[model samples]
Target: MKRVLFSAPSVRRLLLAALACLSSPAPASDRIQIVTEELPPYNMTEDGRLTGMSTEVVQAVLEEVGVQANIQSMPWARAYDIALNSENVLIYSIARTRQREQLFKWVGIVAPMRWHLYSLPQRNIQLRRLDDARRYQIATVKQDAGEQHLLARGFAIGKNLQSSNKYAHNYEKLTLGRVDLWIANELNARYLARRAGAEVPVPVLSLPDLADDDGLSMAFSLQTSDALVERFRQGLKTVRDNGTYATIAKRWL
Candidate 1:
């Protein structure tokens, strides 16, 4: 039957405490969500563990920054969509293109990439220029750098471009005659071919216009804090400077 009311000063102090708690930032570990796809020699699941050149480099960066986060492997389209829309999500082994410059806060280049249009050796597909290949059906991973690059150059899906969820699936389409050509980076094309116990797809055309010197990079979603992005950028630099990057590259590349 008794009620106690807080004094004005006490109530003010309690309100200020609540405001501070509400405004405080979330912990780094709580905000970061690392995602990547099955891109061989860079990011892939091998022997039931996530291990690759870029994955190792990213792990080193996380250690350097003292952040513990688990990397999840998913379909490239799904991972790309999550990174594009989610807050504090990190995606790796992603090519840095002019089209993607403003989309995310880039950490740094983790590995090299060279785009190419590949086909079966027997097909003898030859192209003197980029547009020459438009006559054939080209397989591309959905939302992948190669696909985006071609799409920017006016390649359309369904008509000429066949979009798939995985790079390996594109390669399969090329080999099975379902698609006349597959656009992929040099390392991924060769790695997937070897894994499939098949001959390396012949590179019929090189896409230098689509390739960037910055290579594939680790990047945080645009919603990520600038401070966190810079922390990762510096962490990546440390690994590159201390010879860790070279060692990892030698193992995979």
Candidate 2:
């Protein structure tokens, strides 16, 4: 084989081309990361597959948008942090709140949810108002909308608020008398109680002040491009308009 050498200018051009290739960003679809937690009826891992109401809705939107992504299930806190700090990240079935309005680019609503303060019937807990419950310890998931809402209203961790990593843990705490109240969404509370082979806990107080009337939504990290976010928003709208959203909701809700 004959040895060949490039000219000085040619070598500089080649280096520049290589560096550009190395530094260029990946395609939007390739960089996108989808995450969720095991908040059932919305998102869950069953038989090694990720499936739920919101999961199905998200899948439908992905199909509508012609984007393919695998959903990963993890603890809510970890998932929330990843979505909050990472680029091109998508989190589904997250409650849309005023506190989180500027944190991420909104995609669209996934499901309706109502926050409530729950207690076992035997406990007979009564709450005439939000402040009335401050006397008792409340169970909440760390970084969850419920916890954030309560914290905003003066519920301090290790004081009157007991934070946990999982929603199931909160249920366990409430049933074992470790906590006086479990602040949660109505659908999630009912699902957890019934799945544990126990009677559904009583919704002692409706948290209208902290209610997320806009419902749960699929959101992309703030670093995502406006075009990509709009694609997902339109995809979600397509699913809702074409009845795919309702079909999924009817099956799960």
Candidate 3:
């Protein structure tokens, strides 16, 4: 084949076209927004950057799939809402409950936390099951998984459920007797308690009847593509197999 030499104007046009193609914005699907709450050791903002166990795992997953992550630190309620309505959005360290099973496409179960009802040791509270404790006032983080779980179980607000925006406030509420019981994750409760300088007394009730294996997964919006979700699933497995997951978990857990 004979080579055709380009004229000056043709060369300029070709160069400009190439430059435009190179500088064009990446497709929206190539970038994903990850929303997470400030739950210590799992997901939180440190020094103005998102970093935690779940965060690290998410980062590793994104790296494996070769996608960019735009992480946002927000309240759990707001993040949960965004994940429900937004496309190409991800919410990490969320409880995978039966009520939420069909709402989102799950990547993988990243962590497991035992749910519990905590109270002061001196109170001598007694509960054989979650229902028995329903008569007493319970403090929960607003829009948290525990709060949603309680609501699904018919725990009425203002009657038995007390809501707080911050997780630490629930601890304070429990300690001050503002609420009879505080519903929280086992690890998160201990972490927040130590941070708040509050003592969570013994005799805590494990909510096995409620959720024996409460899995925390990075859930994607329903609008997310199956291919994208599968990519993340494989990425998670890769990290776990390559020991990246364990390394990150050790640092935070």
Instruction: Estimate, for each residue in 2-26, the C-alpha lDDT of model 2 and write its tens digit.
Output: 9999999999999999999999875
- TM-score for all predictions? 0.87, 0.88, 0.92
Which parts of model 1 have CA positions greater than 4 angstroms off? 1-30
- Name the best candidate (by TM-score): 3
Candidate 2 versus the native: TM-score?
Answer: 0.88
What would the TM-score be for candidate 1 when compared with the true structure?
0.87
Question: Which tens-of-lDDT digit does each residue in 1-253 have in candidate 1?
Answer: 8999999999999999999999986685446999999998789998889988889999999999888889999998999899999999999889888888889898889998888899999998889998898899999988988999989989899889999888888888888999999999999898999989987899999888785554789999998889999999999999999999999999887
Question: Candidate 3, residues 1-253: lDDT per residue as tens digits?
Answer: 9999999999999999999999987676777888988887688777988877788889899889888868898888899999999999989888877778899998887876778888888898988888898889999888887888899989988999999787778888889889899988878887877777767655467866454245678889998988889989999999999999888878767
> Model 2, stretches more than 4 Å misplaced?
1-26
lDDT of each: 0.90, 0.90, 0.84
Q: For candidate 3, give the lDDT.
A: 0.84
**How do these models rank on lDDT, best leading?**
1, 2, 3
Report the candidate with higher lDDT, 1 versus 3: 1
